[model samples]
Target: MNPVRATTSTTGALVRTGAIATVAASAATMAVAAVGHAAGISLDMSGAPIPVTGFGVLTAAFSLIGVVIAALLARFAERPRRTFVRTTVVLTVLSLVPDVIADAGAATRALLMLTHLVAAAIVIPAVARRLAA
Candidate 1:
């Protein structure tokens, strides 16, 4: 296989995988939020309760950002899979900072963090798999 053609193929696969992962992560996060809400965990922040759809919206947005990051790493990194996993894991952990300190109650904060983890768990590995080792 020509190197350029191989690279293009890999990039195309990465995009496809990332897009599917984003949708899955978004839906998974939304389901998590809905379950939490049903179980009486408040999705409230500040003074307002977060709608269930907000989870899907935010997850899709951020997961798409993660996809972009993976694409960039695939293009530039010598070990794109390792770098993407490391970078996204750190980012996923860092993403919980706001949830920990939000004005919401403990349960709500925990629920928020859980949703973040769920989305990251769904997206990071999927995108990483498509990256060069």
Candidate 2:
């Protein structure tokens, strides 16, 4: 196979893996958040009601963003696994900034951060591994 064809095939496989991982991570995050909500851990985002649907939507969206980043890195980065993992770690840290600054109570902020970490935990490694493969 030509170099371009090989690269495209690899990138495609990476993207498919990323998509599956994204969905699983999102579902897991939603389940945890639901349990927290039932236990009186409010997920109020600065007084705005964050319904379950909203949670799923946001999770899926952000997870897809990670997938896209992974795909790009797989296609172009000199060292795809290292570059993608490092970029995602930096982005994950930046993502917590809003939660820290939000006017919501401490528990809510903490829960939000946890969700972010959970999603990152599932996505970052899966994508990086695929990229490396």
Candidate 3:
């Protein structure tokens, strides 16, 4: 690690902020989705949207558990923001691999999408904010 690189405390703070925001954001989005469903809006369950929600739950769940996955990923030498955003985009797009490979049904597709979205939401801003220039 570079001597002038982000310090341990700075990395820790970044991860913590990402994690906290992820949980709050995921919960808020989920709650809003629930309300939207209750109000009869289209929730788009016919694709990879459902599992993406699981992504949020999983992301927040991991963050809340203090695993600091982002920190670990950020440990690489690249600039934090660039790394974070690139990784997120890659992961979100990768999450749909199953849907692309298999003739998944509606439920499966939606689940995958949900997971993808949640993961994206968690990965993006969480790392971006900290990695910001």
Candidate 4:
């Protein structure tokens, strides 16, 4: 009756999404923080390497949060892969807003790019796997 009959089930897909989400989040966060630090963002917090780490961490956290939420939502959606592709593409497009506004400097711009990438990495695979299910 179902086009995607419980091949993988919502729980399985969610778990897969979680794994990818966490890894992508950690990597993107670290990569951006390193770049920001190199660019001299300043670390006002407890004598850290630089204050730029906050922005990087925030960006990654937001992305991870989105993935996590989406992972859960995907569980309920009829076609999670399509939903994920749609969601990621829309968000990625939206991520370009900063560039459009020209509000971010080089470091901010770079961080935004990383955020989009990390989100895509997690969403795409999850969706595909769910669709397979």
Best by lDDT: 1
Off by over 4 Å in 3: 1-6, 36-56, 62-69, 99-115
For model 1, give the 10-residue run with minimal summed lDDT: 6-15
- Which of candidates 2 and 3 is the stronger one according to TM-score? 2
What count of clashes does model 2 give? 0
lDDT, residue 102, candidate 2: 88
Q: Rate the local accuracy (lDDT) of all candidates.
A: 0.92, 0.85, 0.59, 0.58
Best-fitting candidate, measured by TM-score?
A: 1
* lDDT of candidate model 1 versus the reference: 0.92
**Candidate 2 runs further than 4 Å off:** none
Model 4 lDDT per residue over 1-133, tens place: 6646663465565666655655666566567666655777532233333344454456556656655656655667776666766776777788767644545456555655665566566545654564423
The residue pairs found clashing in candidate 1 are: none
Residue by residue across 46-126, what tens digits does model 1's lDDT show?
989899999999999999898889889999999999999999999999999999999999999999999999999999999
Q: Candidate 1 or 2, higher TM-score?
A: 1
Better of 1 and 2 by lDDT: 1
What is the number of backbone collisions in each predicted candidate, taken in the order shown? Answer: 0, 0, 20, 4
lDDT of 2 by residue, 1-133 (tens): 6999998898888889888988888888888789889989987876886776666678789989888888888777899899988999999999999989988889888988888899899888888888764
Model 1 residue 96 lDDT?
100
Please state every model's RMSD to the true fold in angstroms.
1.1, 1.3, 5.7, 5.5
Colliding residue pairs in candidate 4: 42-50, 42-51, 43-50, 43-51
TM-score of 2: 0.93
